[model samples]
Target: MASSSVAGEPKQSRPGFFKRSVQFFKDAWGELKRVRWPNRKELTSYTMVVMGTCIFIILLIFGFDLGISYVLELIGLR
Candidate 1:
């Protein structure tokens, strides 16, 4: 059956590859221009916060794994 271009239904108009690519980059640049980039001090603080959180989580997971392994060893599983 032929496709129906009904009114009120959204029309799917896919542009050519080159047109789509150029539009994509233009949209990306436009979005980047609207971003609120941090200053150097804020950037450093944010970086440190992220790194500290990652380290804390890693240590937490390691402690749990170590405890589980010890318990398994006590039971002669490994």
Candidate 2:
């Protein structure tokens, strides 16, 4: 008995490393081209929002750490 391929077409082998790498970059560039990049004003606004959130989180964590340290000192744990 012999195995039969679909539609009488032979299976194709995978491309080599260099060919695959080149194809990957081509696909990536195509996707990047389709992206909606932010303008300068939007970029600045986004940056400021991120910075403000980070500062708020940093202050929150700092406050928690100070409160914990104070309690530990009162109990002579540190």
Candidate 3:
């Protein structure tokens, strides 16, 4: 009678936060397994594009820095 509810029997133990988190990771792994990963050639090409863009931006910033420095030096600010 104490374990029984007004409607029926005892309520089963629901999964706690940690157990739910583990289940979520398991489900995520299953989904990740179905993914079509990029090939090495595509990865290398994308990497090279990123590298080239970074190099170009760096050179541009350095050129601007040098120009500003020269102007400041001319004005005896340096």
Candidate 1 vs candidate 3, TM-score winner = 1
lDDT of each residue in 35-58, candidate 1, tens digit only: 999999999999999999999999
Candidate 2 vs 3: which has more TM-score: 2
Q: How accurate is candidate 1 locally (lDDT)?
A: 0.96
**Candidate 3, position 26, lDDT:** 100
Model 2 TM? 0.83
- Number of the predicted model whose TM-score against the real structure is largest: 2
What would the per-residue lDDT of candidate 3 be over residues 17-62, giving only the tens digit for each residue?
9999999999999999999988999999999999999999999999
Structure candidate 2, residue pairs in collision: none
Better of 1 and 2 by TM-score: 2
By how many angstroms RMSD does model 3 differ from the true structure?
6.2
State every prediction's TM-score relative to the real structure: 0.79, 0.83, 0.68
Identify the superior model by lDDT, candidate 2 or candidate 3: 2
Superposed by TM-score, candidate 3 places the C-alpha of residue 40 at a distance from the truth, in angstroms, of: 1.6
Q: Which 10-residue window of candidate 3 scores lowest in summed lDDT?
A: 1-10
Candidate 2 C-alpha lDDT tens digits along 1-78: 465556678977889999999999999999999999999999999999999999999999999999999999999999
